[model samples]
Target: MLIFVLQTLAEILAGGTSLTSTKQIDFGHPIDRREEATEPILNVYVYDLRESKQLQHSGRQFERNKTGSMQTANVSWPPTWIDVSLLLTAWDKTTLGEHHLLAEALTILLRHRSLREEFLVPELRGHGNLSMTVAIEPAIEISSLWSALTIPLRAALFLTVTVPFEAQTVPKSLVWDRIVSIRNKCLPGSDVMTITKRVAIAGIVKNAVTNLPLTDTTISVVGTEITALSSEEGLFFIEDLHFGNYVVRIDCPNYLPQTVNFLVESQTYVIKEVLLTPV
Candidate 1:
């Protein structure tokens, strides 16, 4: 994904300016020796990459079905967003030529604050809308960056591109449509009667001491596989239950598991609040 982003940026600059194609734009370490034949070239180097903490999610596993149908998928974190830093430099035999190339490159980069979908590569296409920011580094930092590269300080454009790291997915169980039926039986003497009942349970889970909303906490119907995970706000719900006695269990890391017994009568909805003590 990182390489594809860099190549996309190079392509954008190449097409927008007099630089015909990506061939004129090279990707390598600036410290490497430049060939005389490849003079007046553009060099793109990736300097750093880090995951975006703001977009991080706690879940690590995801599930999806191969055939498209009415199926439920346990998708973990969709994809981790990462920030990649790139350095673009113009290398030439003459200072004038170098400045000329740099000027063209800067003009192209400045024209578009973000790379659009039309400019993305084949591998990146249809993933989603992705945009990259193009900006110049401060003059004071340029010296340190070049020093780190162990090369003489030269004019360069610093580019920061945000891209997604693909997540791992596994095939899970398939879901099928559910059907329910009710039949009425009448005795020889009198009248027919019908009965209908439904129940829904909703609740919030929190830390006992901190009272902070605990996300990814699993709440399940005791003897049944039906379960729901608490959201970031610590809210969870289990619906479409028949009236009966049930024991619900809550399990979360670093917290003592809890089980609550409740009897559902003719009520349509039931609300409960749970606080888990730290183990």
Candidate 2:
């Protein structure tokens, strides 16, 4: 993945600048030796990698059918967004040449806020476009960075690229076999079939006085063993219940227990909010 990004950037700069050969572009540590004896080179050094917290999502796995087959494939949880920081430095014997190359590279990068899919390699093309931001780093910070690298301070552009990691894929079971086996099963009875209807009950528990969420509250259906504990957000859910009238009881420490009656219907979700009175 790192190679692909560097290559793409090299391609863009190589095409835009007077330097026709991509060999003039390099990706390595800033302290590395520059091949200035041959030609002026543009070095792209990746210094940091971190996950983007804002783009994080629920880690839920899903399955999709492969092309032209009844078999399904499991796709691992969504890819995580990662931020890659690069220091772009132009290496030339003359200071004027260095500034000119840096300006050209900056111009090309600024033209595209996000890289186009057509420019990406085959592996990254399916992931969609990646976002890139070019910014100027403070002189003090830049000097500190060069000091840490044990190299002389030079003019450089700070580039941050946001890209997604690919999700893992695995083969899942075939659907046709399960369907055929179910159809083959025969019950020695009339042809009339009865379908069972289910209902979903979901709600949140809160404090009666403060109206704040009450976590760790236990909720149960009367005359049944079905029960669920309220989450940190004071939310609880119970599903696959038969259509009927049910009494829901809520219990929590230092709080008065409460009971309420609700009706459940087929193919419907009943939402209830329980407010527990504090002792």
Candidate 3:
């Protein structure tokens, strides 16, 4: 989950139209990364992680399905909110170049307040607990951090991301697979008459004017928590859907939101191409 958070955060920064696709995002110790750097880069270092003191809670959280069946995913123990602190520094050949990159990144960070469900992996989805704050003051001594890394203190942004830490990582698909495997074989005169199958909604998001793929666009089922983010090529696939009609909404940073209605009966339903006009 920690690694997913970092990767998603990087995608938000360097992917899509956020930054010029050429800018590289590197993670690890700044000193080590600096020596290996071959081009201008954004160095992200996760400096600290601790359970959030303000949002503490105990016990389990629960939810129910449309059929009144208890959703096992939500029936697990309550998650502990962990605060992840990241140190973001821009590395470039020239000081002016690095400063310009930082300013651009600052603008992007200020626009986002939460890690949307569209960006989270399957196991970490459902809960809207991955939140972010940028330009926060460092909890640790900045000078000490620089000294420990054996690098000079430089301009950097301290980003804090509060994430839910689950006691166990359970993929909902795996849970269903285990249950189905128990009833793997169906003999003659068997009571099993239905076989459950996972369904998907797949499509591409494109710029209305440029006709180019738009990455990081949110693809959400209007009435459900199901969501998926468009990939680098602008393709998105929301899986685990059952047989039903769905209302999907597409959203991106600068584009106007779009809504489309479609029916799903096949294992994979391809949504018509979506075009979003700039606002």
Candidate 4:
């Protein structure tokens, strides 16, 4: 029997979730000088890592209570802001089970309160549950039974959270560990998945004048959008590259963009280094 597990960590920003007043009611209470009602005001802002940009000019209203005790607001039409985002990293993809694990990890993030406020609540408001579809650049093909069993289960887990007015404050180090545990829980057995594809692709990035390993340089695959940075040791790993042709781009302010094409084949790997020169 083959067992698969999913794992992921979702970090929610502060103030990602909030409460808004939907209806104005007099309550037929005596309006006296002793008891004055403070009118509720609505505030909207972008939830990106950058400072909040007020959407006051957008003129969108808070959606009234759908039911229970919840009032919510919409970010904006067409969802122009990238405030809520996702950073997914797959440690293993050699087995079909790992793909299932990846799907499950993402499912956990979509429902996590911090993830919701950061990514989902901006667009959906009131008591309604968030509907999010996971999109990967280089899609993974998996079994019908796995998808049928995992997809809705993941969605149900996300719907179970009570949305908060602020992003969840979790320690950065704990985030990675917590998601791994959560992924294991979603599966039938095992705590972690061992990676089969671990290869080092080393190279030197230097100044045109002085040849050296360009420390702190970022290497990214165009199609997969997967990336890694060269260490002070001047070595980096593009771990777990799926089978395909990709354009590797190197970016540095002082140097011109370095673009190269490489192919990653199944069960086999390549070791190639790059040299970036100043323009």
The candidate that achieves the highest TM-score relative to the unseen native structure = 2
Measured with C-alpha atoms, the lDDT of residue 204 in candidate 3 is 74
TM-score of 3: 0.51
Superior candidate under TM-score, 2 versus 3: 2
Candidate 4 residue runs with Cα over 4 Å from true position: 1-197, 200-204, 266-268
Tell me how far candidate 4 lies from the true structure as C-alpha RMSD in angstroms. 27.0
Q: Rank the candidates by TM-score, best first.
A: 2, 1, 3, 4
- Using Cα atoms with residue i matched to residue i, what is each candidate's TM-score against the true structure? 0.52, 0.54, 0.51, 0.28
**After superposing candidate 1, which stretches have Cα over 4 Å from the reference?**
32-35, 53-76, 138-141, 171-279
lDDT of 4 at 174: 9
lDDT to native, each model:
0.70, 0.73, 0.71, 0.37
lDDT (0-100) at residue 265 of candidate 2?
A: 43
On residues 1-279, what C-alpha lDDT tens digit does candidate 4 reach at each position? Answer: 000000111212112212122221112211221123243211111111222243212343333222232122223232222122222322221434334434555555454533232344332343244323334421223344225334221211111122213232221110000111112222357455333324423233555555555678888878666888865545555654434466788776688878877664433344455666787
For model 3, the stretches where C-alpha displacement exceeds 4 angstroms are: 16-23, 32-36, 61-75, 169-279
Q: Give residue 211's lDDT in candidate 4 (0 to 100).
A: 51
lDDT tens digits, residue span 1-279, model 1 = 978897788788788776777788778777543456354678888888888654554556665544442343545656678878888888776777778888888888878766667778877776555656667783237777788889887777887777778754532333332222222121244343222222256667888998777899999999998898986667676655555677999999999999987664433344577999999
Instruction: Compare candidates 1 and 3 on lDDT and give the better one.
Output: 3
Superposed by TM-score, candidate 2 places the C-alpha of residue 194 at a distance from the truth, in angstroms, of 46
